[model samples]
Target: MKRIAVLGSGTAGLHLSYALVNSGAFQVTVYTDRTPEEVKRGRVSSTQVHFGPARAREAAYGMPLWEAGPELESIHVTVGGQKLFTGGLVHPAKSVDQRAYFFRCMKDLEAKGVSFVYGRVDEERLQELARAYDLIVDCSGKRGPIAPFPQIGELSPVTTPQRKCSAGYFHGVVPLEPAGVSITILPGAGELFEIPALTALGPVTILFIESVPGGPLDVFGGIKDPESFRDRMRAVVDRHFPAVAARVDGEHFGLCDERGFVQIAVQPAVHRPYCTVGGTLVLGCGDSVVLNDPITGQGCNTASYCAEQLVRTLTEEPVGPWDERTGEAYWKRIRDYVTEVTQWSNAMMGPLPDHAVGRLMAAAADPAAADRIAGWFADPATAYEDLFRSAAGTKEQAERQGGL
Candidate 1:
C-alpha cells in the first residue's frame, strides 16, 4: 500500500484523509496541532458557507454528517443605499461554523482508524516525515507556508492586503427574508456579508465586514471583547447600512461565544504548490497554495474541490514512483479551476465595473437573470467564463492590474 502523510486538519486535510482511509489503497496519518476537543473549543476560524458542489464532495467521501442550517437560496446584493438585486441560487448553500465542522470531521476520521499525530511540524520535522512516507500533502492553511512552494508570481501580484476584515458570529441579529447571504457592497469602501449560519450555538448570523484600509468600514482594529465588538459593528452598520442597523437590537447583540469573534487582514496569495524536500516531492493543497480574499466565499469550497481532484488523480494512476511527473499531473488536474477561482476572487476585491453593476440591475428586474448570476456561487468556474470574464471586461482589465 502507498503510505501518505497528511499535514494539518483543516477542510482539505480532513476530507483527503477520509477519502484515502475509505479507499483502503493507502495508509494515511494526519498531523495537526489540535485534538478534536481543542478544535471544538478553539478560537473561531473564518466563516464558511459551503455550496452544493462542496457538500456533494463531502457525501462522496462518506463523511457527510456535517450539520448545517437553512438552505441559503438567494444572495441579496445592495450597493450603497440601493438594493441592486436579490439573486437566487440553483443549488442551495449552507453555512457551518468551522470550529464545529472541523471537530466533527476529526472525531469521525478517528473512529475510522486514521492515525492522528498532535504537534506542530517545523522544517526539520517536515524533512523527517518526507523520508517516511510515499507522499506528503500540506493543508496547513494560514499556520503554514510549511513547504517552499514558491509563490506563483503572476497569480499573486499583490504582496499586501486590500482589506482588513472584522468578522464574528452572533445571535441577536434578525434574519433575512428569504434566508440567504446578504451582501452589502460599499463601493470605494468595502463589502459586508451577513450570513445565516449553523454553529455550535445553533443557527446564528455571521457578519463579515471586509474593510478597505483607512476607509469608513475599517473600524475594528483594537476591539477585544464581545460587547465592544458588537458596539463597533452596530455603529458601523448604523452609519453605513441603515437597513441592517435597524435589525440589530442594541441591548442583545453580541458574539455567540468568547471565542466567536476575530479581527485580521488576509493578503491574497497563490503558490506553485509542490516542492522537493529530502529528495521527496511534497504537495500543497487548499489555502497553502491558492489563498484568496474572502470577499467571494470560495475558500472552503475550493479546498473541497481540490481534495476531490487530488483523490481522483491518485486513484486513477498506476502504482509507481510518486515523483515529479506524478506531481505535475495532479497539478494539471486542478490548475484550471484554481486559476479561474483566483481570477474571479481577485477581481471582486477591486472596484466593480459599470457593466457588472448593470447586470445586478438587470437581475433585480428579472429572477431568471438573478438565478443565472447565483449559479456562479455554486460553480465558480462559470464566473470566470461569463460573469467576471465577460461582464466586467475582466481579461483586459485584469491584465492592466497585473492579474493572472
Candidate 2:
C-alpha cells in the first residue's frame, strides 16, 4: 500500500482521510496539532451547513453521522428589516458544531485504522514528513498550507478582508418556521445569518455577523469575554435585525458555552493547490487552497467537495509516484468548481449587483424562482450563473442594441 500523509484535521483532511482509508488502497496517517479532547473543548472555530451534496459525500465515505440537529428545509431572506420569501431546499442541510463534529470524526477514523500523530507539524518536521511519506496532502485550513503553494492572482482579487466575522452558538433564539437558515442583509453594513445547529449541549442557534469593517454591525472588537460578546450580539440584533430580535428570548439568550464564539476576518484568496517540497509532491485542499469569505457559508461544503475529488483522482490514476501530474489531474477536475464557488463567494461580500438584486426581488413574487435561489447555496454553480452569467448576457445584449 502507498504511504500517504494528511496534514490537519478539518473537514478537508478528515473527509479525505476517511475516503482514502475506506478504499483500502493506501495507509493514511493524519497529522494534527490537537487531540480529540482538545478539539471538543476548544473554542468554536467556524459555522457550517453541510448541504445535500456534502452530506452525500460524507455518507459515501462512511464518516460519522449525527442523529441530532435540525434538518434545514428552507432559506429565509430579509433585507433591511423587510421579510422577503422563504425558499425551500430540494435536499435538506444540517449544521453540527465543528468542535463536536471534528472531535467525533477523529476518534472514529482512528478506530477504523487510520493513524493519528498529534502535536504541531513545523517546517522542519514537515520536511521530515515529506521525505517519509509518498505524498503529502495539506488540509491545514485558514491557518496554512505550510507548503509554498503560490497564490493564484486572478482568483485572489481582494487584498484585505471584506467582513469582520463574529459568530456565536447560542441557546435562546427561536427557530424560524420550516426550520431553516435565516439571512438578513443590512445593505452597506453587513449581514446576519441565523443557523440552527446541534452541539454537545443539544440544539443551539448560531448567529453569525459578517460585519463590513467599521460598520454598525462591527461591534465585537476587543470583546474578549463571552458575556460581553453575548451582550453586544444581543444589542446588535435588537438594533439592526429586529426580525431576529423578536425571536430572541431575553431571559435565556446567551452563548451556549463560554468558548462557543469566534471573532475573525478572512482575506479571501485561492492558491495553485499544489507544490513540490523537498522533491515530494504536496497538494492543498479545502481552505488551504480555496480560501474565501464565509458570507456564503461554503467553506465546509467546498472542503467536502474537494476531498471527494481528491479521492477520485487518486483512485483513477495509476499506482506509482504521485507527482505534479497527479496534482494537475486533481486540479483539472476541481478547477471550474473552485472558480465558480470562489467568484460567487467574493461577489457576495460586496453590494449585490442590480441584476442579482432584481432576481431576489423577483423570487419574492415567484415560488419557482425562489426555490432555484435556495438551491444556489446547495449547488453554487447555479449561483454563479444567476449572478455572473446573466449579467454578462445582459451586457452583450446592451452592446448589440447600441451598435444597431
Candidate 3:
C-alpha cells in the first residue's frame, strides 16, 4: 500500500487523513504540533459554522457527530439597524467551538489507528517527511504550506487584511428565533455575526466582529485579559449594534472561559496547490492553499470541499508515482469552485455591489429571495453568480452603446 503523510490537524488535515484511512488504499500518518488534550485546553482558534454541504462531507468520512450546538435553520439579516428577512437553509448548520471539535477529532482519528506524530514540522523535518512518505499533503492551515508552493498572483490580489476580526464565545446571550446565525451589517464600519455555538463549557453564543481597519468596531486591540475583552465587546455592542445588545443579558454576560476569545486578521492569498520538495511532489490543501477573509464564513467549508476533491483525484488516478500531473489533476478539479468561493469572499470584505444591495432589499420583501441569499453561505457558487452576473451584463451594455 502507498504511504501518505498529512500535515496539521485542523479541518483540512484531519478530514483528509480520515478519508484516506477509511479508503484502506493508503497508509496514512498525521503530523501535528498540538496534542488532543492541548487543543481542547487551548485558546479558541476560529469561529466556524459548518453548513449543510461541509457537514455532509464529514458524515461521509465517518467523522464524529456533534449533538450539542443549536441547529442553525436560517440566517437572520439586519442592515444599518433595519430588520431584514430571515432566510431558511435547505439543511441545518451547526457551530461547535474548534477547541472542542478539533480536539475530539484528533483523538478519534488516533483511536481509528492513524499514526500521530506530535511536533512542529519545520523545513528539515519536512524534507525528512518527503523522503519517507510516497506523498505529502500540506493541510498546515493559515500559518503555512511549509513547502514552496508558488502563489497564484492573479488570484492573490488582496495583499492586506480587509477586516479586524474579534470573536469570543460567551454566555447569557439570547438566540434568535428559528435558531440560526444572525448577521448585522453596519455598512462601512463592519459586521457582527451572532452564532449559537457548543463549546466544552456547553452552549454559548459567539459574537464575531469583522471591523474595517480604524473603524468604530475595530476596538479589540492590545487587551489581552479576558475580562477586558469581554467588557469591550459588551460596550461595542451597546454602542453600535443595538439589535444584538438588546439580547445581551448584561448581568450574566461574559466569556464562557478565560481562553474563549481570539483576535485575528487574515491577509487573503491563494497559491497553486502543488509543488516539488526535495524531488518529492508535495500538495497543499485548506488555508495553506486557499486563504480568505472570514467575512463570508467560508474557511472551514472551503477546507472540507478541497479535502474531498483531493481524495477523489487521488483515488481516480492510476497507481504510480504521484507527480506534477497528479497535482495538476487535483487542482483542475477544485479550481472553479475555489475561484467562486474566493471571489465571493473577497467581494464581501468590500462594499456590497448595487445589485447585491438590491437583492438584500428585495429579500426583505420576498421570503424566497431571502432563502436564496441564506443559501449563499452554504454554496458560494450562487453568491458569485449573483454578484458577477450584473457586472458582466453592465460590461456588455457598455460595449453595445459604444458600437451604436
Candidate 4:
C-alpha cells in the first residue's frame, strides 16, 4: 500500500485523510501532538460556520451534514441592535462547536479505514516520515511543521503582529431572530459574531470580538472570566452595540484562554507542491500554507479548499519529482481563488474606508445589496473575478455600483 502521512489531525489533516482513504488506493496515517481522546475532549477554537463552504468541504470528503447538522438555514448581518439586512442560502451560516465538529470528522474518517498516529511533527520528524510514505501531506493548521521556501512578497504577504480575538460561549436566552447566525461588524474597534450553535450544553450562542493591534483589548480590560468579560462585553455593546448587548442575559463563559485576543496571520497564502528534504514529495494545507486571520471565519474553508485541490492534483498530475518542479501543479490550481480570499481577509484587518462603510450600511439597509454582499462572503470567487489580487472594491460589482 502507498503510505501517505498527514501531519496534524486537526480539521484539514483529518479531512484530507478521509478524502485520500475514499480513493481506496492509498493508505493515510494522521500524525498529531495530542492523543485522539485528549484532542477530542480539550478546548478548541469556537467556530461559526456558513453552509456554503461547510457543505462544499463535506461533499469533498463524501461525508454528510449529520456529523454537524441539517445545515444552518440562513445568515443575517446587523449592527448595534437594529437588523440591517437578512439573506438566505445564497449562502447560509451554521454555528458549530469546534471540538464536536472536529472530533466527528475524525470519527467518520476512522470508520472509513484511515489510520492516525499521535506525535509532534518537527523538521527531523517530517523528514523521517517522508522516507516511509509514498507521499506526505501537511494539514497542520496554524502551529504545524513548516517547510522553508522563498518568501514571495504577495504570495506570503502578512503584517507583523497578528490580530487578537477574544470569544465566549453563552447560554440562557435564544437570539431574537432565527436565521441560525448573526454577524455584526463594528469596523474600527472590533467586530462581534454571534451565532446559534450545537454544543454539549445543548443549543447556545457564541459572542466573539476581534480587536486589531491598537484596539481597546490591547489593555486586556473587558473579557477575563464569564462575569468580568460579560461586564466588559456589555459596556462595549451598551455604548456601541446596544442591540446585541440587549440579548445578553443568563451566563456567558469564556471559551478558553483568558488572553484578550488570539493573534494569528501568515504570508497571505503559499503552497509548495513537493516540499521535501533530498527528493521526496511533501504537501501542505490549511494554516500551514496560510494561517488566515480568523476575522472572517474562513480558516476551515481555506484548509478544505486546499485538500480538494490536492486530491485532484494527486490523482491526475503525474506525481512528478516530489521536488519544487513537481509541486507547482498542485498549488497552482486553486492559488488564484485562495489568494483572493486571503488577500481580501488581510485587507479587512486594515482601516475600513469611510465611504465603503457607508456603502455597507446602505447595502444593509437595502436587502438586495446586503444579499449580494452575503453571497460574496459565502464565495467571493463566484461573484468577483479577481478577489485575491485586486483591491476589495475593484470587482465587477463595484464598477456597476459606481465606486459607491
lDDT of 2 by residue, 1-404 (tens): 88999999999999899989988999999999999999999999999899999999899888888666799999999888888899999999999999988888999998999999999887888899988998999999998868899999999999999999999999999989999999999999999999999999989999999999999888899999999999999999999888888899999999999999999999898999888889999999999899999988999999999998998999998876788999999999899999999999988888888998999899989999999999999999999998888889999999999999
Instruction: Please provide TM-scores, in order, for all candidate models, with all chains considered together.
Output: 0.95, 0.98, 0.97, 0.84
How close to the true structure is residue 4 of candidate 1, measured as C-alpha lDDT?
A: 90
Q: Candidate 3 — number of clashing residue pairs? A: 0
Alpha carbon lDDT of each predicted model = 0.86, 0.92, 0.92, 0.64
In what order do the candidates fall by lDDT, top score first? 2, 3, 1, 4
List where candidate 1 sits over 4 angstroms from the true fold: 388-404
| Two-way lDDT contest, 3 vs 4, winner | 3
How high a TM-score does candidate 3 get? 0.97
Name the lDDT of candidate 4. 0.64
Regions of model 4 farther than 4 Å from truth: 67-71, 79-83, 217-231, 251-274, 319-322, 382-404
